[model samples]
Target: MITFQLSKQEKVVKSINSPSNNISHCAFLACSHSPQCTTQNKTCCAYILKHSLVFIDTFFKHHNLSYVIIYGTLLGAVRNKTIIPWTKDIDIGIIDMTYLFTKKIRDELYQHGFHLFESFGLPRLCVHKNISNRTLLATYDRRHKPPASTLELKVYIDLYSMYRIYGAQTTSKTPVFLIKTGGSFHALISFQNRVTIDEQTFPTIDNIEEHLVYFYTKEYMHGIMTE
Candidate 1:
């Protein structure tokens, strides 16, 4: 892992594999579904994503964390003011280390029609009504259905560990990461190369819904995937 100079002994997310400093020109949007799921519909899956977004946003807002629309969520935000009409899931993001404080957020949301799912040492996770507690974060869908869209509103969020570099392309894909805060491995990805998220000014607010499940140690975090 690459090390940077810091005054405090803080953990900085690092990518084990480095992409070129040039604008990332590669994109790997895996349009695939889980093996457990077969039929994925906008209504069923969108309900899960929508409920998840509301819960995440409201819970996090109570804790005063800073998050923003990311990836497909951001794209959808710009295109339709909501999840892409046909899209089945939603994506939101926060700066590194916010997940360290998710327990409190989870506890509070649980009282408001949410269910908490045990994640071992991972951050506290929750689900909407009727969602089953699985190892893959709590997920909920409208009942009376087999499965329309395989979109499971998993306890996953896009993490943007962008770097300070010269001549990065906004239109091209930039190498980005999604570090699970359960103190485990990290996930990597090439972001859209069009503009740098680091350059964009996300709204600064009091971060209330933060958790450690997304802010684990740097070493373990770097081992996550770039998929």
Candidate 2:
């Protein structure tokens, strides 16, 4: 029972309940990933992205990753403490110069029982696991996308790396980058340039070189996360 709190300028109805340890099959994906965001009424995924952000925040915090919600997620946290009624996805930003180490992180997630989609560098592309599965991690890859079928991605999350353009300048620009993994999907996935449709600025952390994070979890792979 998670408690739903509202932010300063809120519009969504909130429910005050304790957060649950029970995992659901949903993996928070982009707002456009589902049909519910456009429907007259919001769908379950849309509803959860608003409420479940706290859970994702908890995961990053537990992993010791200093992160802050951006885009729609941040808007919800700052304005409504809930997902915007028209929002269809969740986005979290990380600060760092994305090198070739993305694969290392993917491998680490694999050990945790998750399936790594491509090794980063893909646009509008993602990889994630079933949170509801007894296994903490599992990755289902849709490498070569066929014609009429939109990849049926179970709920997942997107992680972007932020870069600092210039250190000495007080007004140095900030931008989020997408890795180019080769091929149309992951391969030429460069900077999404603008993080959103409404804004032209990219998201960059003032201090990127110093604030990097890594997670250590062997429990999920070893079988179960024992209390």
Deviation from native of the Cα of residue 166 in model 2, angstroms: 3.7
TM-score of every model?
0.38, 0.39
Model 1 lDDT, full chain set: 0.35
TM-score, candidate 2, is 0.39
Writing each residue's lDDT as its tens digit, candidate 1 over 1-227 gives: 32223223334533222122111111112222332232233223343445456556666667665455444554433333434434534444454434423455444544554433322232223333333323122232333342212233332333332223233333334322333343332222332122122133222111111221233222322332212
User: What local lDDT does model 1 show for residue 89?
Assistant: 43
Evaluate residue 104 in candidate 2 and report its C-alpha lDDT on the 0 to 100 scale. 57
Per-residue CA lDDT of candidate 2, range 76-183, in tens? 333343444444446555543132125554444434333323222321222233334332222223242321211344333454443322222222233222221121
**What C-alpha lDDT, on a 0 to 100 scale, does residue 5 get in candidate 2?**
32
